[model samples]
Target chain A: MQNKMIGYVMILAMLLFGGLSTVQAADGAKATNPEAAKVEKMIADADKARKKAASVEGEWRDVGKMLKKAKAALAKGDYKTAKKLAAKAKSQGEMGYKQAVAQKDLKMPSYLKY
Target chain B: MKHLLKKIAMLAVAGGIAASAQASPEADREAFQNFYKNRFASVPMEEYPNGVYSIDPVGRENWEAIEEFPPYEPFIDEGQAMWEKPFANGKTYKDCFADGPAIAGIYPLWDKKNGMVITLPLALNKCREANGEKPLKYKKGSINDILSYIAYESRGQKTNVIIPKDDPRALAAYEKGKKFYYTRRGQLNFSCANCHLQNAGMNIRADRLGPALGHTTHFPVYRSKWGTVGTLHRRVTGCNKQVRAKPFKAQGEQYRNLEYFLTYMSNGLELNGPGARK
Candidate 1:
């Protein structure tokens, strides 16, 4: 009776593992580890978030106005506020103004190094 | 008195003409300033640019004998030998791709189906591995060596990197690259685009800014300053160092994605190996 139970347990374990193998093996020949798939998914999620954020089109004009102000502050050597505003503005602009500009799909400013 | 007045009249008219001539350039510049917010077809800033990658036909200043950093002859030659050497699979690196000189422009591309970002260096080593050969080492490895060797091969391909939007992988990589540039890294917390692209033709202290265009061509350049044939990532590391940030390793995906982004920024620039820069 004990031997039969052991045999039954062995079969169950194989079935469980085989079910998992079938799911994982779906990617075909490539190893396609779960971790790698997870990473790929995370990347995809990030991309989706970025695209959705891009489409919403927030108030970048506020940033353009703020950037104009920041530039003015910087030119006046208000280094403290200029730096703070630049930082604050960058976060705001990085997402907003940047998205519009990127969406404009403007040529990278020619002066920039690729 | 009459002759002097006549001379004055002529001088006045000449002055007006000269003023207009001088103002013409500035006037045109001002006129076009925002006409096209993105005036030219912008290249991606992650890897290399697009459209017929070739070296700048600009005159080159060869540094064949600079001692502080010998032209990367040593590294370049080493790379050449590695390229010709057979892999365990009996295939030369040359056999894995089309002629090396014309292949520099295929990288920093997106493949929608694969959802993967492929950079030039990764592709080179990938070909080797596909032929039942070992992947070349990234830094101080066969892969790194092949870059210079392959750079020699890429001598004349037109810079043409096409980022296919349809490819989820390509688009994803492009976005990754774009973020990498804008995201401030390093202790200084500056983005690569901050100094290089936006401020092209400006200066970092005494160094003159280069227009980011045509940058893709100069990789594996023999920097007389460094005496090494550098991969694009090494340059990225150098940029990090300048900003006081701890640099990433040569083979990290971050750099690869950055390369993709940078190269994409160069959408229509040429790819010249080992171009001279200050």
Candidate 2:
């Protein structure tokens, strides 16, 4: 009876430890996936760029919408689509900021005689 | 050392004079009107209120025909009804505007107390809210109806926007508006000046870009594109989007300041609003 009781205790410990490891492994796979991590970083970089442009009142209309689509793509595991959208958004943000900065001084056009 | 210091002071003073000369509102307006005058020498200053029709003879024929049987007639009638109708509180728009309907020319004025630009549409909405009625939307719908009537009533009234000397903020608002006009924006990289000034007569595909000179004179325009009348701010919003830029809110600071600058530019031109447009 004592030996049987010890055997049952050993089985119970194995089942508990095995279930915990399975859950941890699943979580580890999601956390360590390089593609997902890369896309997340790209999205974050795009958002930062967009905010920088907005700080100068130079943000384009579609940058926010593009970032939103990128996040949705990332959620659906579409890393390639997500990356492309994020990169385009970042480029637009940079262009808008540069455009605004270039015209910091209100230069009257040559055609208008001032 | 004294000689070098003197040279530096002279250069600084010269630079300061140049900047202020360029910044003067009167100087800017003169330059703006001259550009249009030089471009279209035949069109009288009074005719600028007709917009592109003053320049585009071919289009003007069609426009004249349309004006004979104006599409905006119904809106004017509707607006009159709206004007006469009392609010739930037994108060009317007259209660707010003692000067009455023919007061379009005096608006887009700088409100010193608010430290901001107050436009006609904004004032009308304020009147509504004060009378316990819901404020009308700025860009579209019933607002256009009332504006059409007010604009028609205010016809022939000259555009005269006053920037008070007492308030430095008013001048700042005008300067900001001027900056907005000249500054390039959107994916297309076009400023308001690029289309309406630099290439005013140039064709962008099928459309001939209109001159900026009398832009503010005609408002609450009957756009065939919209199949109804719309406000100047509505047209401005459409222009921003056409350039692929995010449009600022209608009647917001950006647009109100823009109107203040634009109307100031059109000073002395007659108001022919509720005008028909393609």
Candidate 3:
């Protein structure tokens, strides 16, 4: 009855708006300390890593490509492959992040370094 | 098909009642998806009844509860002992300030001579360092010296943070913080102002949004997630991770400046230090 109608409405709503966050990611982190020296170093390191990740020749086109594949798998309800690639990309990203934060004498969060 | 529809309706009603009674992360996520799609940035800025880490109704709260909290009573006792210990000229902790508790509001003020802002916590550390004792971190033992003494001193004093409106230096520091809040810098590409300033009541994953205003009133509260009491800097570090940004050092200039801005936002709120947080 009414309950069935509400369930249908709710699922449809999630499909319509599940992807968007409350705030747009495009204009995110405006309150971050840009002049933070440690953050600067880490950003530089991550940039280098991003470039390096993008330039791989044989198996990996880039983390971007992998992420796209991961995203596609996700859209297709393939959680297993999506989780694997996301984990892989995370490790590569973490490696570069480690070098950057370490070089600048900053304490790394466990997730980034370990 | 009609019978099936009736069955589905009955099941759905039962499920909704159950889900409402016992909400799970999955249920909350679905709620956020239904109610707040992408409004993850702005947070509510009103005074929350229970002072904990600022909550963004729109996002998932990372820290849940701290099983064990470090007892500040022992630390405060040590601070008291340190305060009672004599200084160079046989000066007692009482000699340090005419009225110790009356001093908390005057700190983190604009220092025109230094062209910077100084916090009372920093000032106390500076006094200790100048007199040859190691300065303590904001929530560490040395802070206990101030907090314990100031806790005694904190009686009847105002909890307002006063920054001169005309001072450009203060404004500069504030603007820096403002920029940090609005700019997207992390892997998740989220900002503090996004959750705290803009979307206070919007649901993120499971938790309700909270306002950033008056956020400073409940610092150094016992957190269940860390299993101990800590300061706002530690909480900020946790947030950096949520957004996938590299966290600046706790109590570093950035956090201090941000504290300055946050205190300014909570200017008129009374001091309720050592609060409790989830």
Question: Top DockQ: which candidate number?
Answer: 2
Write one digit per residue (lDDT tens) for candidate 3, span A41-73: 333444456555323210122445555565555
Worst 10 residues of 2 chain A by lDDT: A21-30
Candidate 3 matches the true fold with a TM-score of 0.52
lDDT of 3: 0.51
Clashing residue pair totals per candidate (backbone < 3 A):
54, 0, 56
Alpha carbon lDDT of each predicted model? 0.52, 0.87, 0.51
- The C-alpha RMSD of each candidate to the native structure, in angstroms, is 18.0, 8.5, 22.6
- Model 3 stretches astray by more than 4 angstroms: A1-114, B1-49, B52-78, B87-89, B92-96, B138-145, B148-157, B202-206
Per-residue lDDT of model 2, residues B1-278, tens digit only = 99999999999977765664457788889989999999989889988888888888889999999999999999999999999999999999999999878989998999999999999999999999998899999988999999999999999899999999999999999998998998899899999999999999888898788999999988999999999999999999998888877788899899999999998999999999899999
Clashes of 2: 0
The candidate scoring highest on lDDT is 2
TM-score values for chain B across all models: 0.67, 0.94, 0.66
> Cα lDDT for residue A60, model 2?
87
Tens digits of lDDT, candidate 1, B1-278 = 99999999999977654443333222323322222224233434322331112111221222222423545546567777877778788877668665563566687666465556666677777877788876765644445556766665666666565656455566555555555565554335565667654665454675545544555667765554664566777777787767644465675666767676556544445565644343
Interface CA RMSD of each prediction in angstroms: 14.3, 2.5, 15.7
Where does model 1 sit among the CAPRI classes? incorrect
Q: Is the docking of candidate 3 incorrect, acceptable, medium or high quality?
A: incorrect
